[model samples]
Target: MSLMITDECINCDVCEPECPNGAISQGEEIYVIDPNLCTECVGHFDEPQCQQVCPVDCIPLDPGHEESREQLYAKYERIMAVEE
Candidate 1:
């Protein structure tokens, strides 16, 4: 599943760089996660780097964009392919 930044986010900007997928960005109010790009750090790291760096624990799984691990890996592969 993709991760989401909640209203509880402090806008610390720590999470943005930690996201290997480049899914986190500054939103109008709080940091936002693009579900289409988020991969929960699959194919890059064993765990979500954003969540690890988030001090407030505001990042959570986006239930609305639920996806399996295989799907997340596929997304990662697609992203890597595009970059290449």
Candidate 2:
């Protein structure tokens, strides 16, 4: 599953740089993770970087956008492809 930042985010800016996929971005009031680019760090790390760096623990699994490990890897590939 992808991760999402809830309203509980403090906007401390801690999670922004940690996201390997660059899926996390500043929102109107909190951080937002683009589902299309989010891979839960499958190709870059063992765990989600945003969740690791969030000070307020606002990052949570996006239950509404769950996907399998293979799906995550595919998403990661797609993201890297665009970057290249």
Candidate 3:
């Protein structure tokens, strides 16, 4: 599943650069994770980079956009394909 930044995000700018899929971006109020591009770092890393570096612990799996590990890898592949 994709990860989301909660309202607790301090905009420390840490998560933005950590996202390998480039899914995290600066929103009007805080950082926003794009579900379409988010694969929880499946194809890129063992763990979600954003979550690893988040100081506020605001990043969490989005239950609303739930998906299995296989599904997340598929999304990662699709995103990589588009980039290539």
Best by TM-score: 1
lDDT of 2: 0.89
Give the clash count for model 1.
0
Q: Candidate 3's error at 8, in angstroms?
A: 0.3
> For each candidate, C-alpha RMSD in Å?
0.5, 0.7, 0.6
Worst 10 residues of 1 by lDDT: 16-25
Location of the lowest summed lDDT over 10 successive residues in candidate 3: 14-23
Local accuracy of candidate 3 as per-residue lDDT tens digits, 1-84: 788889999999998888888899999999999999999999899999889998889998899999999999999989888889
Model 2, 1-84: lDDT tens digits are 888888998899988898888888998888899988889999999988888887789888999999999999999998899889
- Model 3 bad stretches (over 4 Å): none
Q: What local lDDT score does residue 29 receive in model 2, on the 0 to 100 scale?
A: 81
Ranking by TM-score: 1, 3, 2
Off by over 4 Å in 1: none
Per-residue lDDT of 1-84 in model 1, one digit per residue for the tens?
999999999999899998887898899999999999999999999999998999999888999999999999999999999999
TM-score of decoy 1: 0.98
Our tally of clashes for model 2 stands at 0
